[model samples]
Target: MGDNVVVSNMELEKLLSMKGGKGEGSYANNSQAQAIHAKSMHHLLKEALDEVQLQDPNIPFVVVDLGCSCGSNTINVVDVIVNHIIKRYEASGLEPPEFSAFFSDLPGNDFNTLFQLLPPSANYGVSMEECLAASNHRAYFAAGVPGSFYRRLFPARFIDVFHSTFSLHWLSQVPECVMDMKSSAYNKGRVCIHGASEITANAYRKQFREDLAGFLRSRSVELKRGGSMFLVCLGRTSVDPTDQGGAGLLFGTHFQDAWDDLVQEGLITSEKRDSFNIPVYAPSLQDVKEVVESDGSFAINKLEVFKGGSPLVVNKPGDDKEVGKALANTCRSVSGVLVEAHIGVKLSEELFLRVERRAASHGKELLEKLQFFHIVASLSFAL
Candidate 1:
């Protein structure tokens, strides 16, 4: 922290939210990549459930999705969990437990849109009013909780299973030293620690460590004994923080280039570009293991890194341009709001348009180089 550390966590919290609504630029539409990644963890999810000691049928089986942005992917995850639980209980000739699925994210998330998408199907929980009336027959009750996952969001030992996907990479706040011009770690000309100087990368790593520690501490308090947690997050293959091979780094480079284009065109000042940084970090597996081990609340039953599947890489005829556009849209859906906050709506639109163009132009090359590292882990309370 230095004199140049003017940006506060509160300011970042207010500004940093995914693109809301169901438009093309919205996170809901652009989250197919996330769905693809989540599907890869289906077996792990089952394993987590098998390990968790189920509560009596009378006590509702509580499940919470942290950072569950507005999308079908969120619902799909819950659907998978609920279906697995029911199947397991049914096969054993036991009554399935009542379900409560809580979708959580920042307060700015499009919860209304999320609620609207919740169908009355057997798998998808019906409306709260109807669920109450049909309590005995209803599959689950759905609710939305708005808060940061890095802090305590529920009462002590209230949650049975905690789930989060594609969320933990987002730091609670940008490291203060990186934004401080007076500090050696000041990340000039780069919007992320990716490809930045070692000092700058170290600063971001430190912030991630602190944020994750806090997250585990809070979740440990909220999770009941014998509870389980399943998490999937963006990560890097290389232990080095500056490794530029991960999909997150690729996306960061594209965004930084977009900012460079704006700076070069004289539409936005270099200082303006320098002032903005995404509050995200792709940790290595070692980084995550260290945090979990140090927290001492949860035992890591499974921790492995895997590559994204065929869905991420397009092989269709003449679909390179579409692939590029989709990747650009995904990037914008996640980071556009923050960009808009920093550089205004007009330039933000122009900036992402440049991203789309660049991605479309080099679609094949980009797709070939797209190595998205996904870390999936199952953890249970240590005692």
Candidate 2:
């Protein structure tokens, strides 16, 4: 097995380009289109920070956001935290503690995009400059740390609060048992006939366990003794080994189904299917508990499954008609990416139309099925 799966700069550019041009652009701009799960994550992080701050107000808080794509969400998270701190300071009649933030992600993630989003000069209120100057604070952002989360990337005892959202579920490689021994039959589009079942559902469970252990061990050495960690990840509710549907549903059922269709249509060769796996995994609630407990370094502070409500409905507030329109628009937007990836450019426009129509027909179903989990945990040991 490969020791690490690091996305190269070119690959990262390709992935981001699938969304359109430079730095989250339309996807990030559409407040209505942003994943509902992200907002819930923000809420959970705020609550965690409030709890941590109440326990010790004098300790300078250093917040690090992992897998912080393009740094837009990190900026949003920092904005919320700073605002909360100011409000609390006024309420308690105390000076605000120093604040610092670090944004970390895959080397391919657009740091330039994130930097462009930062204000040149902090504004009077809730501005980066004002917040830092007022609280004797500092902020820094960097990239180029790739591979599994188990590796050390920062100095010891440096981070006070670590936050990651909608990340960390990806496994480093496809299950080894899935590979065929004879002539790589599994890699030759014969997975269904041979090695597919060898790598049972429990394989993912095992991977999660190992990955989480590594993650916790690495974090334990990098976080301050009493610092807190907040992670919001996609998870499953069931643990039945026979439940392939459960595994497929959470990560990319649509993409998988689309891939199957493409194979039948000869757009993608069967050999490709046998050789590559999506590398996405959604651990069950039990799986999550088991992994966290195994680490024995972090304690669960808050954990809950959050459903992905219809983005259209969320954006429209109360208008059902507007909600429908917004949902359609979102489907259209996502289809653009799908067309580019699966269908060739020659058929991109036609495929997009087909996908949009399909989404219109099944949009509500997809919305109802989209759900994730928010896990807020705290670290209690010195690095």
Candidate 3:
């Protein structure tokens, strides 16, 4: 059980993708927190869209949702963009031009589910039914682009506006040094940098900077001269990577605890647990600003970090079990695939069940400590 297992790059790609489809454990059903976070930036998205000028009625105004997981949130975000742009054109006494909304994510993403979620109407469900009858302008077209956002996914200067939420924290992969047994940075007995050594944390930080810079570079080329981007990423209030208040560490610590349960039960070896590391890092506001400024591809229009209280929102206050389930499901929706890939389906199921139970046992305390950083930034291509 202690034997080392090497996972191929291809396997890592698939493993890192969010759980696909509309099943019980699917991301589509568990992305409420992300949706809430995105909605909190509705004004930012509107502001970004308002600055977008559709000069040609013939040319389609292109909008892209990078890291658009399979969920209503993606569609909802697109709907907001489309509606805002439509209204902006109308306010200017100009005819609204054609629109195109592209949803991009990794290859393993549930594109089938995303495409199916689209309404028959072309307006992205922004009251398209009424708009279709009221206006002669063409509705927006939808497409799925499957690939990593860390690389180019469109022609140079082709995209008009870009948006991403609950992403940007995911590195292209866990730092190689953390996975290399011979490396001093190897993260032993930890699934993330939450409690890892400074060397391992540094490795993760270096990888994050590289991935983010590459992402900005690719997006700069793909975006038009005046195009705008609104991004909302998981972030942290403290510079210290091990801060328990950091979103990544908060959720990750619980996950690591659940993984430890399996190890204690002898269901999996400690080495296996150590071998798996989540490729997520919550950057501080300064971390994001530095990367964007250094890249020099975009001008930072707005950048601020807000506290997003408990990812789980309980309608009936004091429902500890419900709160726990919500939090656990959100974690599983994102990390279930990785767990299942590492251990197996059965164990992964048991693992999350344990996650839920542990969370429920201390829901009140967990809820208080679950405050997450929501980094919202609005940017436009540099002159």
- lDDT of every model, 2 decimals: 0.81, 0.52, 0.80
Per-residue accuracy of model 1 over 1-383 as CA lDDT, tens digit each: 22123345677876567899988889888777778878877888889989877677778888999999888898898888887888877887888877888999988788888888876633353554565465344467788888888889999999988999889989999888988889999889988878889998888899999999999999999998888999988888887787735645455666678889999998887877788888888888889999999999889999989776422434462676787677678778998888777777777789888887777776776666777887888999886
TM-score (all chains, Cα) for each model: 0.92, 0.71, 0.92
Clash pairs, model 2 backbone: none
Off by over 4 Å in 3: 1-6, 123-131, 134-138, 244-246
Off by over 4 Å in 1: 1-8, 121-138, 310-320
Highest TM-score, which number?
Answer: 3
Per-residue error (Å), model 2, residue 375 = 4.9
Name the 10 consecutive residues with the lowest summed lDDT in model 3: 1-10
Please, what are the lDDT tens digits per residue for candidate 3 over residues 1-383?
11244344557765577888898778988777777877877987798787775667667789899999888998888888877887887887878777888999988888888888776655355553454665543367788888889998999989989999988988888888898889999988888888778888888888889999999989888988778898888888878866535566455666789989989999888888888888888888888899999998788888998776667667754788986687678788888777777777788788889888887887777777777777888998777
Q: Candidate 2 on 9-92: residue-level lDDT in tens?
A: 234224421132342223344334344557656666677766554325565556777766553666777666666665676688
Candidate 2 regions with alpha-carbon error over 4 angstroms = 1-35, 41-43, 53-60, 86-94, 122-148, 179-198, 241-247, 250-253, 310-357, 371-383
Q: What overall lDDT, based on C-alpha atoms, would model 1 receive against the true structure?
A: 0.81
Model 1 is weakest, by summed lDDT over 10 consecutive residues, at 1-10
